[model samples]
Target: MATGDTMQLVHQALRENSLFARLDAADLERVVQMASVRELAEGEALFHEGDLVEHTHVVADGLLRVYQVGPKGSRQLVLHMAGPPESIGEIAVLSERQHYPVTAEAALPSRVVRVPREGILQLMEERPRFTRALLRSVAERQFELLLLLRRVAFFEVQSRLAQYLLEQHATLGPGFPLPTNPELAALLGTVPEIVSRTLSRFYKQGWIRLEDRRVWLENEVTLIAVAKG
Candidate 1:
């Protein structure tokens, strides 16, 4: 029942994804043949916090925000983005848990392939190599999350903000427009006005030049000190 275009996109998504890279054409075709694509709308939740773990989804396009419900009845944003081939409910896959730990919401209109848990487990049982590769992917994600936790726990907001800016600058290149004050705040897990005040102080001290959303590191040494402190 899959359309030609849907099949093509699934193939393209799998091909680009590191997780599925090792799958031979025949295996990849089998996966595509078995998976189901589900469409989600903006602000719509794919799963509620504590929902039974039915399927693990891979974002084919758009974005997903993973969050938990706070005691105050607020949504505590955990991860702002989930892109293609990044699987959700991966931990559930390992533990054989019946429920998910957090709610997953579509940040924008999105398409995802929902792989049933039983099907995946069966595949892994039959293909040990595939299971090994999948575990590696999960471990990598765990390491990255640990680093994020360390940042939140040990670093002061200004220092964390500076380090994040430096990272973005490295990826986006120097002379690229720095992120706007608000965007920077979100990345640092803080608010815009506070970020503005901190950045303004740094700007006056000649540590950085912020024009728009781009940050140019005027003094790498000072910035490193800031990140460290």
Candidate 2:
């Protein structure tokens, strides 16, 4: 059961979300009523990689870190941050195999609004707009995956690192914590030594300013150029 405040938060997050924002008022209300809030402590997993899909989630507060762990126990970070109004496992509602390919864990104390798979599929069948929204989500994810593959195949470490920095700066501002290098390395598909060397090179090139656990952009122009390559 959801508390009044938690319910309110879910309603607002769904309204703001890309997939749900297009829903009509009554349809939105119905979906909200079917939703329940889940609270998670730091490091708690909402689901492990390969878990059978039962529900999708909207982050009502804090960050959800989506990743996969290799057989050798190495983490491959898929998404470092999924915060308010962002969703996970939405496409799984349409998946035939119906297993979440990545694990979603709370990077900090977090709140999630759980939407059951059967209910969302039912809504999709009855609502044309909802179905279209789901299709668009699927298309967007595919496009992003293609881009990721292209980058991994063709882009150099410095280019990818520059792109990553620019993306993080866009999402999290320039001075956010540099707290997790190993996870960052996994996200970049490289080792920490290379990431460190790339950052050192950027520092020498006067493209970035680095402090204890934070970085500030000194030259967006150079970073943008490198990212484009």
Best by TM-score: 2
**What's each prediction's clash count?**
8, 0
Kindly list the per-residue Cα lDDT of model 2 for residues 85-148, writing each as its tens digit: 8888876778797798888998889989899898889888898888898888778877877777
Candidate 2 Cα errors over 4 Å, as ranges: 77-80, 170-179
Candidate 1 similarity to native, TM-score: 0.82
Write down the TM-score of every candidate.
0.82, 0.90
- Which ten residues in a row are the worst by lDDT in model 1? 73-82
Residue pairs with colliding backbones in model 2 are: none
Best by lDDT: 2
What is candidate 1's lDDT per residue for 1-229, written digit by digit as tens?
3698888777777677765667788877777888878889988998998888888678889877776656886325364457776777777777756888888888779888777788778778877777887898788878867877788789888898778777877877887755456445655666678888898888899988867655788988888888997
Q: Local distance difference test, per candidate?
A: 0.76, 0.84
